[model samples]
Target chain A: MIWRLAFATMLVLAAADKRSGYQDASPETRAMQDDDASNPGFLWVQQGETLWAERTGNAGRSCADCHASIRGVAARYPVFDARLGRPITLAQRIQQCRVERQGAGPLAPDSDALLGLTAYVGLQSRGMPIQVSIDGPARPFYEAGKALFETRQGQFNLSCAQCHDGLAGQRLAGSVIPQGHPNGYPEYRLEWQGMGSLERRIRNCMIGVRAEPFAADSPELADLELYLGWRANGLDVETPAVRP
Target chain B: MMRRRFLVLTGSGLIVPLAPMHPARATPVQVAALIAELVGDATLRDERVKLDLPVMVENGNSVGMTVSVDAALGDVRSIDVFAEGNPLPHVLRVRFGPRAGAPRIATRIRLATSQTVTAVAKLADGSCWRDRVDLLVTLAACID
Candidate 1:
């Protein structure tokens, strides 16, 4: 159960040079992200705002009842939980509270309800730096994530690192390869024509490479998220980020 | 309606010979017929009006569009926008009053696929000016 492999030594990203996917998007896209009225992601944020006040389930409570505010909470996501004994993403944390504290049935992953709350909470951390912990119990998961990111897979046999790391700025066809940062998640991907979680984005890449995607609720996703959060340490969270 | 005079101008011989049964998915023939309907007997000129939209669109869901006509083209009457390939060919129409300032309209439209979007500007003098833009949707790299 002990992970003996150490990946920190091999990977040396110049955190200073870490550029957000926002910097690589088109001008029109940047404008869309900048304009709150035009940003479709705000739709989810608005939905979350409503859900925050509406009481649900046996507890007859709203998210507002316990957590008065969501500000700065998203910046510390994919956190190591003592009870769960594993790292959980911001989205999962929301569901955990809904099911346990609010007594609401678990919302389906990638559903509007879940995405709405995630986008809402993530918005509070807009411009705040990502700061996921990789120490102690979170370390094993982080290392696992690092291994997955660097491993070759799928019909194309491409690794996430081979593109996002080795060729971050290079053109893959027309699009400049993004460093694959998760800073802007529950993002409004023009391709999807709606909001999507980090899991959808990662699975999409796997599918793009003709590789099998992990399950929507896979622990591997959380592990990957932990690693990505650690990698994007100082990058600002642009939740509900407009992406082409 | 005054728009029906176009049917008379084209004569019964070229009145499409078919009704728009498929209200969705505007065909090239339907687009031409609709343009004719808007044009009436007036000739559709190809100058002094502009329809601006991105050539290579990232997605078809919400493509930004702008339509403008030259102020020198006389008192503006109306500017009608159309997409040759959308479910509804008549995307939007902006009617201008005598006091309306600039003859321009900027908004977004969804493209069902690659096609030409045209903007027809009608002056109060009955002269019609028009512009068109062809666009391609880039969509996504991975998902099919």
Candidate 2:
């Protein structure tokens, strides 16, 4: 009888935990939903689609003038740049395009242009599963990415694992926390009036963890983005996703 | 002796400031109702619906929120989320395929004000589950 009672108690606790957003799988279901079909994100996607084709900011070069199509480009992002020999996120790719290709001034990370371009590029790989390289030169970055995932620092003193890996598929207040997947970004968070870059989202979480948010294009953030893309290796791309 | 005197002085000093206190007020129920309407027939049972929010949101603009359901895959079909105080209460509706693995999701959201958030879960066997959570927002994060 005592053993049965103890077992029941444990089950209740487990259920309670699962009901909280303490599990790694908490974000999975939300990532797949299509709630905001009429949201401004769609509008941004349309605008971004235009920007991807239009030549602007003095170089007479639109994103389309050089790159053939966004299809293969999106899926192969966060790649190791031999010049930097480090990973570069999709946002960084746009920055590279603007500075090196278009001779346009670099837009701030959260600027509408960056958000739109990221969303537009991300849409091109809509159904492709994420594929970050984890071998050869990408190995060191993968390790750095993994290490960042497990480290605990900041005011809350809680690590990413505390919520994502250690307590995945669990709840915190009353919502089910999904897995840490970048599949649904550059998402259209209702919280943000329009589309947001995946890097901005990461910065948002860092604030939640009480860590000092990195600058938009900082190497630390790039490393973290690399890890996120690799962590969600097999999930389908759902850029411009809608969230509550 | 000095430390002892300071301790005694502190003890006495602390007692003089006793004042009436009020319990933290609970969030209104309309927010919960809004969530219910958004989720449809999914019932609000504690067993299946899981809702997560910070006890105190730093700002209402982009509070992190998550919702999930616990049901036998065969018995659970879909889950929906609603933020009563958000500009759009119908946050998300997640359907599970046999291949989707588990029923779970998470995302950051905007809350227009301090309000109760709810999640409703629908089971394939014609049953429903629900849960509601109260979020205290010291600084509203969503609207800005």
Candidate 3:
């Protein structure tokens, strides 16, 4: 009976820790939210809306001509892509669209086109909770990512858990370190001069850990992104989110 | 003070063999002067710019950042990015049109080493806004 009570207490503490800050790891979203009057995602969405209609490459096929409206498309991303036998991020899917449908070359991993399209698609699911499925094939990818997150890397000898999981909401230097959530992506990073992809952002963190950055389309990044998406399961997609 | 490496361009199209330098020397002043030359007629304020950077970074290859100003985007016409001790001081320049909604940007960058990062914003009225952040880099990330 005493052991059971101790276990229950530990579980409660863990739950409270997660509730307090780990859920929203990125900088506060409110600062970037310009109200309903000015949606930052609006700009990227307009660009994507245009691209969806415009034909490209030799085939001259536009993504919009076939799929048509993809209003809720964003919330379903980082899905278990059957062919790859792993979870695929929205950026990966967008690249596939260009390569398979349009027969065009893959955009540079974090290229502006990829970021723009990812932002565009992500906005379609704005205000909807990110609902990546972790049940089937996605389970393996999530597991792989979780392992990677806990693994320490580079000369810093720090794991992703150190800052995001362990010390989240605490000040590192002067900035309030966020929990490292993946909900807001295809974000318009102020320093980037334009839109940015989750891949690039993930790569940024890799560098922070002093780990060598994987190639833009590397399997590792895909797995890591899947894991992060699953972790942020119920959070709404806030693509083109502003960060500071 | 920041550390700087003298960059030698190699045949492989890569920068090689980083040679360290003193930040308090003439290098940063020259960089500042060069920036001043690039942006003419704008005032440099000690207050208006707010630069966010880490206090201690293990690597210089990727440094997180945030920059903002209290002024409206319409009132501002230009912005520039500078790393006082990096190999190249002029990182980027942004010119805004009337439709440019905001004057804030947050992104990641490469700092050769620990140093002060500054952003100078020039308004349409010929006034200057400047912000500086002291970043502590424990391990320089850009070893290559």
- Among these predictions, the greatest lDDT belongs to 1
Interface RMSD of 3: 11.2
Best by TM-score: 1
Candidate 3: segments with Cα more than 4 A from true spot: A1-29, A35-43, A191-193, B1-144
Candidate 2 deviates by what RMSD?
A: 14.8
Candidate 2: count of backbone clashes, pairs at least 3 residues apart or interchain? 52
Candidate 2 achieves a global lDDT of: 0.63
Give residue A209's error in model 1 in angstroms. Answer: 1.6
- A1-244 in candidate 3: lDDT tens per residue? 3553454345335633433122332332344444433445557767777877789876789888778677878887778887877777777788788888898888777665666677777777887877777787678788888788777786466667655666556555334556677766877554343566777776766655556877877788888887777666676777767644
**Model 1 off-target regions past 4 Å?**
A1-12, B1-30, B70-77, B85-89, B96-103, B112-115, B134-139
Worst 10 residues of 1 chain A by lDDT: A1-10
Best candidate according to DockQ: 1
Writing each residue's lDDT as its tens digit, candidate 3 over B1-144 gives 123334443443222334455444325786789768856766567887787776765445445677777788888777788887776777667776777667877765777666777788887788887887887754321222
Per-residue lDDT of B48 in model 1: 82
Is model 3 an incorrect, acceptable, medium or high docking prediction?
Answer: incorrect
Error of model 3, residue A139, in angstroms: 1.4
lDDT over C-alpha atoms for residue A178 of model 3? 68
Task: Report how far off residue B139 is in candidate 1 (Å).
Answer: 5.2
Give the whole-model CA lDDT for all candidates, comma-separated.
Answer: 0.81, 0.63, 0.66
Candidate number that wins on TM-score, 2 or 3 = 3
